[model samples]
Target chain A: MDLLIQIIFGLLTALIIGAAMMVVTVRNIIHAALWLIASFFGVAALYLLLEAEFIAVVQVLVYIGAISILILFAIMLTRHISGEGERLLTRHWWAAAVVALGLFGAVLLPTLAGNAWGIPLPTGPAGTPEPLSGVEELGRGFVSEFLLHFEVAGVLLTVALIGAIVIAFEERSRRRRVLTLAEEHTLNQRQKASAERAAAAADMAD
Target chain B: MRDVIEQIINTTFGWGWPGWAISLIGYLIVAAILFLIAPFQMLFLTLFERRAIARMQDRVGPNRVGPEGAWQPLADGVKIFTKEDIVPDSADRWVHLIAPCVVVAPTMFMFAVVPWGPGMVPVDMNIGLLFFFAISSVSAVGLMMAGWASNNKFALIGAMRAVAQMVSYEIPAVLSLLSIVLITGSLSLVDLIAYQGGLFISSSDVAGVPDLGLGWFIFTPVGFLAFIAFFIAALAEGERTPFDIPEADSEIVAGYMTEYSGMKFGLFYLAQYVLNFLLCAITSVIFFGGWQGPGVGWLYAQAITPANPGGGWIFNVLAGALGVFYFLAKTYGFFFVMVWIRGAYPRLRIDQLMDFGWKFLIPLTLVNIFGATIWVALTKWGAAEGLAIVEGWSPMLRWAVAFVVTLALNLGAYLFLARIFAESQAERLRVDDEVLERLTNVA
Candidate 1:
């Protein structure tokens, strides 16, 4: 049973790492996003294995459902750059590789090698089994223990949303600027042609 | 079924087999059941949609293929199977291939938490509702992948519209369910259905009420509003007509499905109908008293089980049959409504869909949530539970007060939001006319 458990864990770990590698390596941006989703699913499965059903579902909901779709949306909305023969790597690829290796060595090596490595929650008596929590504990914690943090996070999200709106409306304000250009600028024949182009752009914006 | 499977496996194998092996067998059995049910559900839903829509359109739909055209979907399935599975030359081959699997998988996973009859859940998950919706959302990626991989402009557009519509509408749908969740204090669909086992007033709301199986959430004003919002959102989620901008046939040439052919297209069709069936089933479960109609509770109580092995197996079969009958009746009724709406209404534009979802439905559901809170306070809470005023009131009186308060709030919110939406739309059009007139005059 223990060996079987270990085998499942090893498989999930391999899946996660392999998928993550594919996410980075896939030349097609859409394919890369899909690979990233596989990584997310692997992480979610890991969470499920750890008895965090709520977190696992949330992970899938947010990452696979929303984030991955958003990435694909972004890929589609932008210029079609994911076709064959286009190099995915930058000129500083080797530098990135070296940095990644160094970072992994610096962070992962010590922690992985350390004795007291796992998450340290409040432990009960030596033989007493720990209780696994789901939505109930999380909800209670959000309302009671972590109430301020929860509210703060919510407020932060609201502010961020407002900030996004303001930034988006800033572009709308530019359309008004284009409308006012005719009143503000004095034009020669050459300048008039440029002004007409501006007018046409504004009209198109409308 | 899972528990039964486990018991059977354990009994046959004696004590030698470990718990995990039994559990694995149980899981496989449950998964197999769900997987099997999904395709059949898809088949029936497709045939049902066609026939139902045909009747709505005043046509005798598909009377040829075996007994009121029950075998129509089967025939269609065979045809789809035989057809050549075509991938566009420009398509990203792998994503195109895997998209159908990804799309189909979530709908299958959703069946895990869906209680078909009493003690008939594949997995009675604690956070079943959340798990179901979250799993459902994962399919958006599949839809997007299909669109993007197709390398067709129409497909991409369709995919974008579908994803946006789904994500936007999910807020109202989820928010509407929040009130129910708060009311019941449980996200389990089984528990939710179990809560509604009494006459008019739920057993959860008023203890000792006879389980007439009439206490549906839709009977309450808050739940009614939530039901309205949820059904609309469900329509959007299922991509039924009026919210079917994702695959508006005339506009985008079959939308994201333009490039897909044969079994690949068939897979999408299967996924869609199955999804619609689940949505309708869930709606009935959450809002209507699913599998909780007359005689079900009593039969279930007398049925053979771990608690009462001496109880007759006769009651078990009777209970199962009656429960499933009621559940399917309610579910099919909702599906008929979907078909009715599809026949009645034309598809909305993408912008209109967004506006309906974000502007109207979201605010309505949000206010309904507030009303739901108020309802919870009046119906559930007392001085003991921290609401001091409603302490000494009778359950009936409290229920009445909750009904009045929530009704007023929800009705007022609906009117106000409708006014606001109308005014904003009118205002935008007015400004557009003014701007247009000014531009034309200047030219």
Candidate 2:
């Protein structure tokens, strides 16, 4: 079982890294978004391998489902649909590389230096015989131990949502809403009727 | 399944098969069965929808292929297989080729978590409900890929509308299910079914209730509202008519499927019908009693389950047969309702569809969730949880009060929302008419 898990983990790690590379290297923005989604899926699979099924499913649900689609929509609406002839890099590429490398090392060095590289899995408290990360336990902890944090995060998200709507909202007087088919028909009919009435008055005067 | 395989190999044959080997064989067999079942269900659903819709339109469907057109899908399949697969000249070759598989694969994966009968789930993951929705959403990415790869404006528009509709409706769909989850307090599909084993009131909600296998969640007001919202959302998700704006034939020719032909188009068709079938199956399972009809509970109790290994194997077959029968009947019944709806209602315009989903269904489901919480408190909580008012009441009485309160609350909310929504729509039309009059006068 351990061998199988390790093999799977190794494959997933490679997939994640490959997909992440593709996300940056891919010329087409849509293809890059697709690659990013693949990377997200790989990370979700890693979460599953760690027995964090809830988190794994949420990662798929929120990131791949919502965020990736949003990104695709943004790309499609804002940029060229085919995404051809796009430049891959700018003049400051070396600066970006330096910053990226620095961040990666900052994240990696502490774990590499402070802890043993290889270790067996930790067991739960004696006699429990199960992991303490069940969905029910997580829910209880959220409401009890992490209630304040959860609420604050929720409030922050709500604020962001409202801010977005406010930014998007247009005043009724200033907005140029498109006419529906029915409204257009009514306008056309009224124009035709008034034209006929004006022609009739001219005939009577003649 | 592993237990049955192990029993046969190790106990009966004295082969002493390894545990992992048994598990591997079991999963493989189950997977093979599900794969077979998914496509067959898709084939039958296509024929079923055609025939039912034809009957609604006062015409007989294609009955010449086989008895009542049973083999029509097979005939169609042969035609699709023989046709030339067409990809637009400017289309992305790889993405176009891979799009159909991406769309179809998630629907096949969804079969893993659905409970066909008692003790008859594939994985039975603790996060089965979440797993189902998460996997379903992955197909949206496939849809976007298909639209983008085709290099066609209509396909792109169709895909955009499809993704937008799916993302919007999913909120109401998941929120409605969240209420059920709140009430049942479990994400496992099997646990959800098990909770619905009583008379009108679920035994889980009220103790000492009779096990008639009729305590479907739809009996409760919250469940009814959720069922309506979820089923509507499901229609949007499945692209069923009236909500099939993505592929509205009058507007866009086959939507994202415009450039697809031959087996690729057939694959899209298969995925769609299969998704529709799964949606109906889930609706029946969650709102109606899935595999939970009279005689099923009794027979399953006597079956050769792990809890009762000494029981007769014949009871296992009988129970499974009866359970599957009930489940399919409810599912097919829902599918018929889907067809009926397609025949009755005109397709909604895009803006109207969005307005209905975001304004009507989402709010309705949200209120249903609150009602669900109240039902839980009334039926389950006690003085220890600060529900001192309901502490002295009997379970049945409490159940009745909860039912009445929730019913009133839900019904009131529905009527109020409907009026407000109608008035708002009318007001918007009036404003449009006023603007049109002013513009016409000036012209």
Query: Candidate 2 falls in which docking quality class?
Result: medium
Query: How much TM-score does chain B earn in each model?
Result: 0.96, 0.98
For model 1, the docking class works out as: acceptable
Tens-digit per-residue lDDT, B162-245, candidate 2: 999999999999999999999999999999999999998898888788898999999999999999999999999999999999
- lDDT against true structure, model 1: 0.87
The regions of model 2 sitting more than 4 angstroms off are A80-83, A102-129, A170-182, A198-206, B11-17
Q: How good is chain A of candidate 2, measured by TM-score?
A: 0.81
Put down candidate 1 lDDT per residue, B1-443, tens digits, no spaces.
Answer: 54566566667755656777778887887788778888898888888888888888889999898988878888999999999988999998988999899998899888889998988887789999999899999889889989888989999889999999888988999999999998988889989998998898887887878888889999999999999999999999999998889898887898888999999999899899999999999999999988989899899899987888888889999999999999999999999899999999987867678888889999999999899899889988878878899988988889989999999999999999999999998986686556544554454
Instruction: Give each candidate's interface RMSD in Å.
Output: 7.3, 1.4
Clashing residue pairs in candidate 1 (N, C-alpha, C atoms within 3 angstroms) = none
Q: For candidate 1, report its TM-score.
A: 0.91
User: Candidate 2, clashing residue pairs?
Assistant: none
